[model samples]
Target: MNLADVPKEKLSPMMQQYAATKEKYSDCILFFRLGDFYEMFFEDAILVSRELELTLTGKECGLDERAPMCGVPYHSVDLYLKKLVDRGYKIAICEQMTDPALSKGLVERDVIRIVTPGTLIESSMLDDNANNYICSLYYGTDGSCALCFADLSTGEMSLAVPQGTTDLTVRIMDMLSRYTPAELVLNAQALSLKSVMDFVKVRLQCAVTLRDDACFSLDTGRELICQQFGVDSLELLGIEEDGAGACAVCGMLDYIRETQKRNIARFISIDVVDSAETMGLDLNARRNLELTETIRGKERKGSMLWLLDDARTAMGKRLLKTWMEQPLVQPLKIMARLDAVEAFYKKSVSLMEVRALLDNVYDLERLMTRGLFQKASRKPHRVT
Candidate 1:
């Protein structure tokens, strides 16, 4: 039902609050925090009920029409949130901002987090080995595009700016396939760019969010980068001043800020990737090489990685994948890696004992990440 058709005075006090908040995030499903449940109302209720197989119900909101409703317990909300996010839908979590017992009127609340396919940090919602990335694309007027990828789960951030070549579509698709972002954010105005837009919509088929074109700005973006990375110069981070990469990063922060509604201490640490020094591989090359999977039907059983991967821990497995994707182009770095491997090879007696010990080890990387995030925002400083 069109909520606008109902008179504002007809809504209950609580529902008036809901309607106001809903207007701002119309594209997303609002999970209003009740006492112990995350409630969805109106059309959002009907939609998620069918999608998540929740019981469809109704609530009397004092309006001419009864509001549709569905809900899940707050403790088990992650399961429901994952379902919507997996289906490419965004969810705004309206939280009680104050102690409900102390409040005289209705409990004061606001949306604390707007969860999207990207920007998820909870361990249960993410994969152990694969990185969860949220990327922003800036289509420049000069026929070039600047893309920024940020993995909040791992605190990894990188930017790439390249002009359209004869094989522009393939190159763009290759870059997308390489990282495999959970969501792609772009300017609403750029949807008119037929060829490029079609690739994002059809070929990629990932979640795409369109924001106002005015939200992306070179100066604002540079400031955001400087604030986040604590750098005075963009060039220091390998991002050009007033360039496409800069614009893309700015756009990314914009969407993140709008959704998260809080500080992103996890993403404060950033890395400027040197794409030139790494070997580049496309999707086709990855499949043909069978680096991580078999060529016959793409399973892990007969792959090169399957045979070579004797990794005992999650971090080791992730590092192995990195090695498979980007072999060192510099001879010095390559030699250093070879020397390390050679040392391991010669330690025949110690290597077997070490591997046996590591088989019982836990995933330290993700455990430390969750610990640091949940316990405190400030990370412990390293000793020099």
Candidate 2:
């Protein structure tokens, strides 16, 4: 409910604190920490309760009329967050920052992270064989555009600048189709492009975020790139310091930092993408060919991926899908892949042994990245 809709009564100190925190993240559904429960107040409570089918209640906020409230236990909040995120709602995980036992009055609390469709890291919320990419795009005034895609869970980031193209919208759509990003962030210029915006919203149907133009500052982006990779210059990476690529990459990093509220994921490098290296498959091409899923039920059982996929591990399956999505166009690379497959085919017994070994291997890429986030802890203690 809007502030005008609420009863005119003085709020309790704790409720007042919630109001102040909610103001900062007006777009997100704030999970305000209240002892053992992550409480939702006012509009957040109403929305979440209606969506999740939870019983909406009320709390005394120093007013005769109780404030609307709903809550999910902190230990089991991931389940609730996943439901909301799948429906394209952003969540602000406000945590109790200070100990209540030692506090003089009201315990301090703040948002530790803002979880969006693209920023998911929990194993339960992710698909084992699919990369959950968060894309960032910057469309310059010169009709040139830069695209950045990063899988936060795997710490893999790649930048693509679709230059020398008559229709950059087509190139950008091709890139988006390949990655199938869960979330997209666009600068003011990119968002203003009608065709691209339509493709993103109507076709992709993923969560879209609009970032301030200032966030794509060239100088700041250059510095962020250097600091992130611990490099002196973007020259070594073949990215122009003042180019749209740097701006796109910087916007992505800035958005991630804003949402995560900490340096958890380590982006070791930013790989420059060459579109020509891979076969271009636009949305129509992919859909008609049924490259990954069938056209009817959209299941993998009758698709190209199903026929060739014999991967034993989650990582192998994911890599195979990546290879399927972006078929190598360069002769040398194709030959190298063929040679590796030939070697495995000739050594049948060795291949069997390799598959047996892989059966026991976990998804190490996600495991290592999740470990860095310190999310690998044991089950949280049940709060009484």
Candidate 3:
């Protein structure tokens, strides 16, 4: 069969299924597993090859001609996946659902997972000291809505119901700092709220989930909460809809149930406080003063992670992780941790001085990557 003579109208069942899957997840890079490699086709092939620095190639699809294709070996998927995610791309992993040897017809193909930066669970892609968050919003019957957000990695949870304009910004900002959610959910009717959410989304490169109009009711919020936690009613959680707070809390829990991939059996104790309870810091100050920006680059050999290595004790390492999880909260706790850090700094024979340090360390992206990869050259003695 000639290369150009492949019948466009006579595509095999497997080819048809692949085309349908491609259409279903148009926005995502579909990693279609064929055998040893995760393959990309047509435009996905071109785009992925260029972005990932992989070789561009083609495959014979049992037709008169070859189809455009590019692929990376299954074992090296994590490396390429990390690169794509770091560049802010969502991936839909489409695996062959059935064994080719056992199945009679075309090999079954289905999307097994959708990977995003914030939803990542692999230890290599995540920081032990940082939290990955997913958030959802529910608009009530009135002109109000509840925002629910959770971080499964660290088991942190938070809720906020902002009524007027003043509280809205404060609440949203507070939630942003408190949870650092990677994705957000909201109803279509909540345009104003969506605008605020969008600002956060773009600035933080977060994902958003817009609910259908049919599910925009307050009862839906409660039902979602009940369903997520597998409770018969909200009463079991000691929460009632006396006001908007319950709806907000329930909506967040519901969002978590729908989106979270893992069964997080344990939750870390979260100390809840209003934005007013803590001193407000501007976005610039928060990012710069706290060293949040240092962790944005390559995984290992970053600055924040470097500081964590020199933390000297388990408590210090735990504190460092907590700082990355909720960079804006618990100033007192951070100060206490800083004191411990300072004691170590003074005693250690490092060239850097302790007196020049600021309240919150800056260049966070650098710090985190460095700390994540830190390892001792030799085994240390185990102390009793």
Candidate 4:
């Protein structure tokens, strides 16, 4: 169903509008806002109908044959969207900008936001204990690479620049395994790097996105970082503008703004992660150890985390997993963690009471972050 084959004059006014919007977002499934439903037409209609098991229907456009059509009720759109996103499909949510009843002609509609695997924030679409991270990778010509990880649901951003490594690929893959990002955004250089791209797309099975090269420029990155942190320069934050980390962060921020279609006030600061502080485990090592899941079935059973985890809340389980992946290298830090464990062991009664209290608690970190983002965007925030 190529629209290019159909003459513009043959399309009805409303369908002409859909064609124009769909042209701009050809990579995504455009959910065109119609009265009480988000409708799909032509290719989108046919594909969505089969995927969601919706009835295949037709509509009278200006053509001799009716246009293929299907739709889901707008109120229950999240369920359909979750299914599509989980299947690795991107969606462009076309929303009506004005009331149709008040308009004299066709209602004006535009894509308000894009929903991707990385940018998901709805509670129903996410796992409570896992962070859905969207990663940005910037590969410099000088053999340096920067990786940035951000969880849109939690508003947490962190960057890692692995330097002085003989095999940068191993370090890069190690970081990727630790975070297990749902999506990866790359610059021109990074996209051209065949090894990294293959590992991300094939081994990790992550969605890859390419943005404009200008977004990763050094000067642009510095300016965006300064503006985001309300600082005069990168020096104030101990970050070099020419560095790989800055480039990665800048590209990430640009990508997020593009998908979200608005400024994100959630990122108040950026954390520069020091890889030396923790024991570095490459991809193979993590897989062999089965730190989080078994290597065979990739399930939580028979894994180190499964054996050790007794967390009462979602946040605690996530924190435990984070700790398991990044073991502290410093003796003082290790001793501090052991001391805390010893204290909890000595006061079993108090620990039991604390666990009981945590059982009633929700994931406050993401809950509050989603509330703030929604309020800033002036949309309803749903947290379960």
The prediction achieving the highest lDDT against the true structure is: 2
Q: Residue-pair clashes per candidate, as listed?
A: 0, 0, 28, 0
lDDT of 3 by residue, 84-140 (tens): 877777788888888989989788888866676655655456654446666666665
Across 213-290, the per-residue lDDT of candidate 4 in tens digits comes to: 798887666777888889998877767768888889889999889888988878888888898789888778898999
Position 16, candidate 4: lDDT: 97
Error of 4 at 286 (Å): 1.7
The Cα local distance difference test for each model comes to 0.77, 0.87, 0.59, 0.85
Tell me each candidate's TM-score: 0.89, 0.95, 0.67, 0.93
Top TM-score model = 2
Candidate 4 regions with alpha-carbon error over 4 angstroms: 375-384
- Model 2 compared with the native: what TM-score? 0.95
Best-to-worst order by TM-score is 2, 4, 1, 3
**Model 2: lDDT of residue 354:** 96
Candidate order by decreasing lDDT: 2, 4, 1, 3
Model 1: CA > 4 A from native: 163-166, 189-193, 293-302, 352-365, 368-384
Judging by TM-score, tell me the better candidate of 3 and 4. 4
Tens-digit per-residue lDDT, 277-379, candidate 1: 6766776788798887787886877888888877877668767876876667989899999998898899988889988888777666555656645722244
Query: How does candidate 1 score on lDDT?
Result: 0.77
lDDT-wise, the better of 1 and 4 is: 4
